[model samples]
Structure formats: C-alpha cells, structure tokens
Target: MTWTLVTIPASHYCDKARWALDRAGLAYIEDGHMPILHWRAARRHKGTRTVPILVHDQGIAADSTDILHVIDAHVAADQQLFPAEPALRARVAAWEERFDRQLGPAARRLVYFHLLQDPALTTDVVGSGAPRHERVIFRGLFPLLAGLMRRGMNITPAKSAQSREKLQALFADVGAELADGRRYLCGDRFTAADLTFAALASPVLLPDGHPVIRTAWARVPPAMQAEITAFRETPAGEFALRLYREERRASGL
Candidate 1:
C-alpha cells in the first residue's frame, strides 16, 4: 500500500517524520492540512488528534517517532534511524526523547507566542501548504484559532518566558556536546537525535529551503530577533542549519 503522511506542513514533528522517510528513500504522499483542520484528518486516519501520522496498508504510525521506527523497519540497516550498535542506539533514543519532550515543545511555544500576535504572518505560516479555501478560512477564523492554540499550547507570558529559558539551556547543552568536536549528537554518524534536533530547531533557525515560509527575520520583534541571531551563531544552531542544507535537500523529495 502507498504511505500517506498526514501533517500540518509547517509542523516540526511532521518535518522529523518527513526527514526520516526521505532519508530512508521511502515513497509517500503528504496530505497536508491547516492547524485545527488537521485534527479531523488525523482522527480519521489513526483515531488521534495530533498529526505527523503515517498510514499504510499494514497499519498506522500515529506519531513522528513511530513513523521513524516504521521507516527504520522497512529500510536497510545503513539507512536506519537508529544505529546498529545497541549502546549508541540507546544514546540516540535518549537524546531523541529529550529533544522531543523539551526542545520541540519549547520551540513551539516560543514561535507561537510571537506568531499569535500577528494574524497575517500566522496565517502565512499555517496556510503555506493548505488549499486556497482553507487559507481563506484560516484567515477568517484566525482569532478563534489563535485563542484555541494559545490555550491548548499554554502560550502565556509566563510559559513563553520559561520556554525561552529552556531553549537557551538546551542549546547550550547541545553546544557543549559538540564542543568536543563530535560530528553528530550520538557519534560520528547521523542518528535520530541529530535529525530531531535539526528538525525541531528549524522554527528558531529558519533555515533556508524549509518546508514552511517563515516571517522575515527583519520583521520579527527586536528582542526575539536578537535571540534568534545569537542562537544562529551558536555551534549547535549552525549544526542544525548545516544538516538542513546538506542532508535535508539531498533526499530530493
């Protein structure tokens, strides 16, 4: 059966799944949707309200990580997300978990906190891969959608501040790990952890050729732009950008 990846298009988690599938050379169709509209599609496919869900003839992979595991199972060993060595694979999994639990949410909160303030840019970001009618609908319902997203994602002043701090700390940790001059997060080779970090960090880095069309850096709030500039200069952030420029496009997807 052909694989269909249901996604919000600009979602970092969805990017992770996309990267994994592409890296594994798996052919799949992307069924993209706008924000809240994706919940219905996700539920129809996998009985879940979140996206990055993969559906195939065999069954459904309801999460990005699950999709990566599915790809790993189908692909050759060398193309697997996890390393062959057990210990290294464990480290990769642990790092992937850390980034998924912390970096991903923190990045989302930070980005949404700012984007929610500007309806036009928010629409642009969310409507990138959606149909024209859906884009118009999103613009029309943006106020309601923004409110729901803020509440559901807990994007308050306090949480946004906390998310910034968390993101800085995590970036510092990643920089420290790379300080020893290691090529990848877990080892010399690319692994799931590196992909997770690069994909999740895309919101902040706004690497060129990203699936999403981000607000211009010049138009960002001064304070946020400063933070973004600093992060982009960091070793870890550079690593993520390099991964996107080198690995992400190489798949030719």
Candidate 2:
C-alpha cells in the first residue's frame, strides 16, 4: 500500500513528520485538512487521534515522533536521523522530549498572545456547537481544537506576560546553544532532535516557503515582526533555517 500523511494544514506537529519524510526522500500522499477533518481520519488507525499519523504498508504508525521512528527503521538506506555519536544523540533525544512537551507550549502561547488568533475548533470536533451537517459527517471524531486554542492563545494580559517571558528564556537558551558554529541542532548531522525543535520553534525561526510561517508570524505588528525576524537571522535561528533549506525541503526549500 502507498504511504499517506494525515495532518492538519500548517500544524507544527505535521511539519515535523513532513521534515522526516522529506529528508528520507520518501514519497507519500499528504492529506491536509482543517481541525475537524483531522479527528475523522484518526479513527482509521490504531492508537492515534492526532495529526502526523503515517499509514504505510506495515499497518499504521500513530504519533508523529513514533511515525518518524518507524520511518528511520524501515527506510531503504541506513540514513541516520540521529547523531552517530551515542552520548550526543542521547542528549539530543532528551532535548527533543523537552522541546516537544515543555518549550512547545510556551512558544505556542507566545504566537497566540501576540497574534490573538484562536480559531476554537474543539466544539467543531466534539459536536458541541458545530452545524448539524458537520456532526453527521464527523461522527465519532473528538477534535482537540479547543485544547489547541487554549495552548495557542493567552487571552488574559497576565497569562500572555507569563508565556512571553517563558518563551524569551527558551529562545535565549536556544540562541546560546547555537552561539558557536554548529550547523544542525545535534552538531552537524541532521537528526530527529533538530527536526523536532525546528518545526515547533519555526514560528520564531521560520525558513523560506513554509505555509505557517507567514500566517502565524506575519499576524504580528510590523515592528515586532522585524525584530523577531532579525532574531531568527541569528546563529540559532539561522541553524534551523539552514536545516529546513538543506534537509527538510531539499526539493523546494
């Protein structure tokens, strides 16, 4: 069977999976949809109600990171997404976990606070306030849109300040780590850790031709955009940008 990537358009989760598939030179169909459609597709697989699920001949791989793990194992060539250096690879993997779980929330909140763009999709998924027609079509899919929205936006001023400060600290660490001349996050070779960090962190350090970069970051004011874009031009952000250029989107980016 052919491989397919089921995901929400412009989702950083989806972007991470895409980065892996693209880097591996793997061919797959991309099933792009809004928040509601994502849940509908998740039921077809086992153990997944999230985007970036990969369905290939070897049954279905749920979870974005899990999907990438499977891809690294099954690809024809022994192309490594992890560093060959064992200690460094382990450290990078630890960083990837934190970035995916912790820093990800803060960074997402920063974008939402600055943009105020919360398209609350939970109701649409769970059949709360959505149209009757949508409920019928959606069936059992419970959308996580609201949770995503809550993570994406900080409505109260206090919350926004807290999230922004957290992100500022995160960025400083990332910048400091890249203060030296390492091209990739794990120091030279393209690895899963870098891909995870780059996709989630892309809001601040966006590269060329990414769909979300324009909508997410551009929503900010001109002066602020300029400031953030310049920061992205730094060694850390530049490292993420180069990874997207040379590895993630080698075909187009």
Candidate 2: TM-score?
Answer: 0.75
lDDT of model number 1: 0.85
Residue 63 in candidate 2 has what lDDT? 75
- How many residue pairs collide in each prediction? 0, 0
The TM-score of candidate 1 is: 0.95
lDDT of 2: 0.64
Candidate 2 stretches greater than 4 Å from native: 76-78, 114-148, 151-156, 211-227, 230-234, 250-253
Evaluated at residue 192, the lDDT of candidate 1 is: 96
Total clashing pairs in model 1:
0
Predictions in order: lDDT = 0.85, 0.64
The CA root-mean-square deviation of candidate 2, after full C-alpha superposition on the true structure, stands at 5.8
lDDT by residue for model 2 (1-253), tens: 7788877645677778877887787888876555545566677665556777888878787777787787887664336666557897797788788778866666556554454332332223223323465545444333354345554444455776676576667667777877676666666566777788778777655467454453345345674577467658666667667667766664222
In the predicted model 2, the residue pairs found to clash are: none
